[model samples]
Target: MTLDEFEDTPGDEAAPIDMLEDYFGARGWSCDRGGDDEIVAHVQGSWGKYELRGVWREEDRVLQFLAMPDIRVPDDKRATLYEAIGLVNEQLWLGHFELWANSGILLFRHAALLSGNDGPTLELDQAETLVEAAIDECERFYPVFQFVLWGGKSPREAIDAALIETQGEA
Candidate 1:
């Protein structure tokens, strides 16, 4: 699915990471530019802390962003966590959750391709939305992962519990 928002510009396009940095800075988020094409930002969510990374590939004109929460699945919980990821991803409209194979790190990833007549341009609003989506999805599903890893709950149970809608605060 096309998860990116774009606007047509007449001239040369700045790298996507640069645009992402500006968005993060505007939100007062702590971010570090890894290089010309990469940036990492730290954001706090209600469930946990997050590390958001943006990488721009000039060759392919693609911008990839990842949001990783401050939680890790133990080796024994890997199987269960994978099941929970599938359930969580099914409900998402924009991005999906994944557990890194090597690190067992859970994260949300989405990519936008800046290909067309417009070149590699990304609007500020699009950048902001992209970052917001990542954090928002991560926050929404944090408890599901925790349910499987720590609470010994089944994947379906975790998803059901996490997705329950409450009418008002207690």
Candidate 2:
């Protein structure tokens, strides 16, 4: 998932909030926030075991399916988890998962499939396929994709910037 493999497109017009409102309303999901440039909705799915979060920013929209990992780490092993997550994140980034602001998005989705138990043996082809799926998803909801993709800078940079910005703001 190198930048060379990603099909980076220029940003488009902002997605209208009403479209998201309609989509969520049909599903009985209620809006949690209704700011001018952002909207968040909490949706309960049929399984009733997981909570879905739909976030809409001025230029992007994302529907994330949340789940807790099955394995729990001891307090001392937290660092190991952080390292593992970082490795996965880096692999994702290399696989066309662009870091925008504080978040990351895959332009194509097979990238996710590469994250196996090993967490370090991701192949480029798998990453490419994953990115393709993400692209297709983005096409189906271009406004949301654009908003999420373009709103943030790179994730790594954003975190550093946030720390500095917050320190200054404080």
Which number leads on lDDT? 1
Q: Using TM-score, give the best candidate's number.
A: 1
Q: Cα miss at 130, model 2 (Å)?
A: 14
Q: Which ten residues in a row have the lowest lDDT in candidate 1?
A: 1-10
Superposed on all Cα atoms, model 1 deviates from the true structure by an RMSD in Å of 5.1
- Model 2 — TM-score against the truth? 0.30
How does each model score on TM-score?
A: 0.88, 0.30
On a 0 to 1 TM-score scale, where does candidate 1 land against the true structure? 0.88
lDDT of 1 by residue, 43-76 (tens): 8899888999999888988899999999887888
Candidate 1's displacement at residue 128, Å, is 1.5
RMSD of each: 5.1, 19.8
Against the true structure, candidate 2 has what lDDT? 0.32
lDDT of 2 by residue, 89-156 (tens): 44343222222222222222221211224322223333233323433333332322222234333434
